[model samples]
Target: MVRSDSAGNGGDAMKEHCGVLAIYSMENRPVAERIVKGLAALQHRGQESWGIAVPGEPILKGLGLIGQGADANAKKILSFTSNRGIGHVRYSTRGRTTLENAHPLDIRGEFAIAQNGTIANTEDLESVVEKEFPILGSTTDTKLAGYRLLQHYRAEHDWTRAFHKLSKELSGSYSFVMITHDGEVLAARDEAGYRPLCLGYDPDTDTHIVASESCALTALHADLVRDVQPGELVSLTKDGLKITKFAAASRHYHCPFEYTYFGHPSSKIDDHYVYNARRKLGRVLARKYPFKADVVIPVPDSARPAALGYSEESGIPMEEGLMKDRYRRKGSLRSFIEPTAKSREEIVREIITIKPVVDGKDVIVVDDSIVRGTSSRNIVQSLRDAGAKKVYMVVTFPPIRHPCYMGIDFPTREELLANKADGETLNVTDLNSKVAREIGVDGLGYNDINGLSEGIGLGKDEMCFACVTGEYLGLKKDPVLRTREEMKA
Candidate 1:
């Protein structure tokens, strides 16, 4: 396996996108403080900006990490005295990385919404809004969706009805935590459950928590309530919890990337332990792409569990082929606060140390996913320089070809390695082959889509495989979709 030289040496880390945390106090206790704490735990998900919206008060937000002075903003927000609030920590993957794009986007009367997925048909949606409701600010599709909903809700004057209408019109993946002015906290998962949203309980305070991961609830000593089922709308109000179903029923395609990369190791999604799922994926890969190697070296952190499972399944010893320097800073200190491609490359080069054991050995590298092939290419080059005799790469997920509108940040089609080349040029017959050649590897393998779905204990129909297969299940062709199709044509 290839290694990122910058694993342990702490320059800057590759960060995932935004995390959403919402809390509604059943007993009307001070909820803002709890929301702040929960967002702190989820800061690993997104680090660029943080915001919180409390009823009857102005939304509070700013640039930078959640802990670094974000607590002060939370404390300030706590002064609002609202029992229902939605908080967001953003990592700008699509829109401009600016304060305007920071979330917990509030509309005056209808609602305030925080979202975790990217809107793939944003260009189309934006056109509809510009012609229909032209007063909206910010470039994010999230804000556009919020305004569209606000417009619908103002006319309908019913939260559930407005949401149903908006869901029908929206395209792409989104798990939303929305707060209505009527003091209702509504949580809706995307039709395919592409982004994670779980429910939990704070027994002592009798509060209800909804977050992108279970780990946030655990940090606040909350009990696991349940995962918000796909295509389900959960409403929490002073009355109680209520569920409303919408959209055409289809199989849930939960994002496989969650388990392989984005999800926290301690979290559980769709009832399966995330870390355990990765290990199972590794085990499945070993069975499907068996290779005789002297050592199984994980790509580090994200790939560790799969590597362990691979070693156990292949009867190969797992060795730490790459040593991470925990203390070194790679580039400009400011870049760590806001990571870029240049910063990430520098971090990768600075963080890893090669082990003597891999110098003369045949090695198998296990990784979560390969997006553009650049990171994997760098890792492979680093390993070759470290004296590995042979390097084989294995990915836990299939090649990603399509851009994700439901929130996973994949490059556009033209930039995807699989989309750009045929089997011969890519070197392998499948995803594994394309990745292997891109990174200059002797052999490459990827877990088939079925293998991945089954390894996670989910049936093919129960998970969102859109990113893997480009087949959207519940998406409807509304005005936005139609207009976008016309524009493209």
Candidate 2:
């Protein structure tokens, strides 16, 4: 368990939810090693803690990166031969980052479950479960949900029926994978589809694979079947694959942030490849905000494709103005995990080295989005110090004003840049000016909500922009921004 008494800085950007993977092998073989490889590909989604659960074997889990987290106990589960298994890589959003809160949480040693997304009514559901099962250990929603499922299974005696009943009582975002005591693998997504989940098939061994992103399937050489539809339940056994509609998709709010930042560039979500979607966002930004600059530079990894699209559309030459120290990538995680302010700034400075290409040249910087404006501010200051004549900031997503309630980490308005703007009414130009002034940039431009829809090739109704427009789809009440103190209470 990695315990920290320090509270985090306000400017830290949104964090991703957990990544889930489950495999059902037709041949009688252990799948824990393959699960590790697939999880390695999805490691970007989480870094705090990870776990793998094989039925009839002691779970393997620990804190920190996957390789560093697992110890000798890992081999006990890895060597155990099981036809079915489930794995999870987690970055805590709802609970403390500790071994006790890690995934593959078992429900009375009957079912093992791993989940991505926050359960909005976690406490209420826990209260409901305590009426029957009095003993509970962890504070994570995965544990609460698992106990609820166990309660349903005991009464209904059917997995599908139990899942259907569980679906009606739950709210908020979730994409879950589970392994039963008898070697059955099950998966499902919430009604609104605020998170991503998909199914795939392996041809070599005729195994079935399910994961949070399509990239995980690609990592294992599996062919993607389709995205598990919102409110759908999927089960895999030695017999075959069975999918059932547990609940109708009331309002589909596939997270737009997945394309903007969270998801891998190569992964496809809801029929759109994230890399192409980001490139389209850049093209739209260039057309909307035409800036005169000698060169364009991306903020690195996530913003690279968008910068390429901006350069192509604006006819401005794109250059690598900053060389990211590949070895320093691990240090970047400290910016998000460390609770102190000074450590965050120091990590940002160590990650990217300024190149002389932008010296005496007007530079245009393309970034995915600005959450707290910390990274963008640091990048802008670095550019100015490197002799860049002027710096202009172009963002792919619209200004985020409200906090996200689904599964994103920035759940409070105090951590948002657009919250600094003057009125409740959303004013793009006003918000842009305020953000530019705060980040110490000469000018700033953001994609409009409509433009984001057009670029991503989805209608405004098909995707969730609640963080930017404050139009929630499935939530009951307006999301309140709670401080860390309030969260502790």
Candidate 3:
């Protein structure tokens, strides 16, 4: 569910690394402007920085929220014309946050690439790329992958073959969109479908669009086409959409967190509607956790659907006990992906606690997942200050014990709350008790992996539960299957 750069992963809260948007104007009309709209729709995936790459121009990139902040020229510069382009919104996991690392990473004039998901084994990839396609300034794995793409293309001459080679060379989750010097836009989903990437069409503009989520397509008034299949490479050009099954892992490992947390509620990932899946998660939580609370309060925005299902299933009235202070400067920020402790703190401050609803009541708070436990502690403290008689926590997803190496923000194993001081992951009951005590909650319940799979209508094997289960699937070319010791180290 997270979209953070596999490179800049350090913050406590889980982050969606990057959102990719690609638009190819069938009529060859200016699409640079539409790319901005699509990226804005996908901004939640990443907010630290954004950039767009189109042919015949240097990639336009900026640090911090797109078209805003100290980058005074962003708004105007993003308006530059191009009939087709690829755009990216980035949140780092393995690299520093700066314009130099902003994506749509490219080589001289051959191609540019923007991606969602982690290329966990970038160090090994360096031998294949670093010297020839050297990156400038601060580095992120994405910049390296960009050059690697070109390196493969150089040898293969055919992009489809190059992408297939890259698929074999790559060792983690990824969904990529790239633009060629000739304005060709191509999208490739990793072999396992580890991150979401889909296609859409806007009849009005006659544009072929690709984005991390279908929600971006909705923003462009585009019709949802099928998801770009796992191991599929789709090209959008004058010939329309050309799909090739460049590679396929033996099994698929779709990220479950998308349905639980990161994905836009209105979007569709594969065959499942994200909103419905979340509601099912809430219903499952209510059935299993069965809290006799006076009110069920959702951690704003992302958890709203799950909370609603919890309230409806439990017959406990759902109250808007907490709402984002939209008028506040940081109100729109998703706490988990804010990047900085200060920004994340501001997010906690932006929560408008409806004291009247929590006062003198036994309240059950529902949330997507607990990654670091910092936010949970602060949220519960706020409710206590609001006079909540008893506060219980119900989490939609299971406890996250291991760190995600696939484009998720929790790259360091020690940062996870479900682990011991020495970095040993805890069992469900022990983890629940420990997290509840640490967060000052009376009770806590986390969905187990099975419950989570059932709720999302997916079998355990169908999704990537590596962060929860410590079972990495489909990361190829000798995937770095870190042992507990190495993870802690």
Best model number under lDDT: 3
Q: What is each predicted model's overall lDDT from 0 to 1?
A: 0.72, 0.78, 0.81
lDDT of 2 by residue, 83-170 (tens): 7788899886534566666777766667778888877666567688878776552256666777888888899998878888888777
Write down the lDDT that model 1 would get.
0.72
Please identify model 3 stretches exceeding 4 Å from their true place: 1-16, 67-79, 131-138, 421-426, 477-489
Check candidate 2 and list the clashing pairs.
Answer: none
Model 3 CA lDDT for position 51: 82
Q: Which prediction has more favorable lDDT, 2 or 3?
A: 3
lDDT of 3 by residue, 218-255 (tens): 98999998898899998987888788989977789999
lDDT of 3 at 239: 83
Count of backbone clashes, every candidate in sequence: 20, 0, 16
Model 1 poorest 10 in a row by lDDT: 1-10
Q: Candidate 2: lDDT over CA atoms?
A: 0.78
lDDT string, candidate 1, 32-126, tens digits: 77788899878767777887877776667777777764555545664767888888888754333655556776654557777888665565666
lDDT of 3 at 486: 53
